[model samples]
Target: MKLPVLVLCLVATAAAAPLALAQTPIDPLDARDVRRLDKMEQVVRELRAIVFQGRDIGKPVVVQPAETDYQLQEVSRRLADLEQTITRMTGDLENANRQAELAKRDAEALRTENRSLSDRIASLESRALAETVAPPGGLGGASSGLSANDLFSEARQALTSGDYAAAESGFREYVDAYGDSSKAAEARYWLGKALTARGAHADAAGSYIAAIRGWPSTSWAPDAVVELSRSLIALKKPADACQTLAEFAKRYPKASTTVKTRAAQARNQAKCAA
Candidate 1:
């Protein structure tokens, strides 16, 4: 049967591909092609002689048909899916960058807030350390921001923490600021203790005496006597030390056992008269 000119033309096009495909066969032939390699090669050569050369050689090559519409549509669908996947990945990358930027800003804000709070705490501590002198103008006054007890406690903490200078400063501030306050006697007593610890026994004696004179009936009174006697001894005033201890019991009739015991020790050491 004679093939139409168009059919023959299609065969000729495939026929021309063999030499080009042989030298550089970029695409791999199909499985069916593997089974017919020799037959396809021989037919291609024959069709090249008859159609493209316009001379009869052997039988012609029966070229395979192009892809059907369904195959082409399936390929288009797969390409579209690949494009959609790439678009989604790009959007996800952008979102991740935005989230990272927001997290960085939040961390920076937290650091700034922490710094501000730390500075405020340091300022409060500095205010607490200022010397307690006055035009009656210190923290012990009612107009003062710090309460008498609060001011006193900070000094006590300094003593507990072994910051003798700060303790002395804080206690003086307490006494000058709130001399009439309930905590005043205790503050003065501790001030003396702080001074004595730092070898300022003369100054310490004055604080103990102030405790004894101003708040004599307070719990610190007998203790003040005990501490005052010690400070006096340190000042090389043994007679005054004996006298202070002698007055301890008469001054604090209901003194604590601790205070009584301490007084007895001081008295014996000073060889005071019973």
Candidate 2:
């Protein structure tokens, strides 16, 4: 009876797999889950040989043999183990899906900002061109009246194109020239990314910390939280990394899906418990 009950549970879970797929992210069954299912299949085969073939289909299979009861207990234990693992895995999948959605939204936001910055840059250049016609050095000066958003977007483009040094310089200049600009927080965050890309984790952590402290309310601040943790990890400061991640949820109560996911992962990397 216990053997049939266990097999039925396994079959029920298999039937519900499609619903899980719809609710969770892409991977419904990880390697451990696959291995556990394989083990369940083998257990079912053993039960079929031991008790299923000789039993009446609708009757309660009360096994009299002590050895058969032991087998039943073992199968039941395995089933319970598999069930618990599946529960945890489902939670992880859902979290991953949320992160993916957040990343998609973030990308769209970046595209929109880029377009807006480009329009402003065009307008600024037009005015600069008119001014340059009257004086040869009018628009050529470093003080040529470009907005912070325009300069930040250009530096971001260079970063996207893998020009780390150019990106770093541009970001630094923006931070220095427009420290009070709405985009300065993001610029500091990207400066950290640029520095980290060049194997300067120590310097990168400083920029990331600045991003967090200077623009804690900005959208990029949450991302800076995760990046700061990662930079600490690179500096062989696992405890500090874990500490930074520990405060993530509290600091950024409304962090994006991806930022939350990355925070969890960074905590794991730091070997944080609970």
Candidate 3:
């Protein structure tokens, strides 16, 4: 009977232990509160990422008013300098263009005048050929004749070759040796040309006068008359130049452009004197 009672007491103790475990209490708010704490921790971590990105990784730049104003002032100053330099360059270019135009006009006028003079010389040369006379001497001073033509040709050769002393001597010999020959007129005229080349304007004027008077019927007379006036002008004798030019015009009304050019030059001297 005591053994049966001990077995029954063990069974009863085992069953009571299972029932107490099943009846233990559970907290309903504990799971919800834990979930809420986890959500709060996630939100804090997201906020830290946004703050770090904005402050440490890629922050917006703030401009200072003073720096902005200084940059604007520098740009304005540079623009002003550029404008002034452009204006000065424009003025210089305009001046250069004006000068170029003036030079072009002068060159054109000279060309026209040269063409006219060339035509006139061609006509005069044709007329002179018809009335030309042979010099007493040939090209050389071989014989006793020794005319002005030989000496003049030699002088021209010398002058062309830049031998001034020989040219002067030859021209002087021409005037002395053949004063009465028709070729003497040409010699005397060329002597004046040679003298002028040697910078002896006073002597040149005298020789030109002698040439004109020596051969009034020859073609060289009109040219000599004009040349004498030009020589006088070169000598700064404007009064004499005017008188000689007046005589030339009276003597040769239908003179060539070369003669007219000398007359015009004489008038220029007279005007300068005035």
lDDT of 3: 0.66
Evaluate all candidate structures by whole-model CA lDDT and list the values in order.
0.72, 0.73, 0.66
Instruction: Estimate TM-scores for all models.
Output: 0.46, 0.46, 0.43
lDDT of 2 by residue, 214-234 (tens): 336776888888988898888
If both were scored by lDDT, which would come out higher, candidate 1 or candidate 2?
Answer: 2
Candidate 3: where is the Cα deviation over 4 Å? Answer: 1-149, 160-162, 272-274
Query: Which digits, one per residue and each the tens of the lDDT, describe model 1 over residues 45-128?
Result: 665554643335445446565578889899999999999999999999999999999999999997886566445434422432
For model 1, which pairs clash?
132-173, 140-177
Pairs clashing within candidate 2: none
Ranking by TM-score: 2, 1, 3
Between candidates 1 and 3, the one scoring higher on TM-score is 1
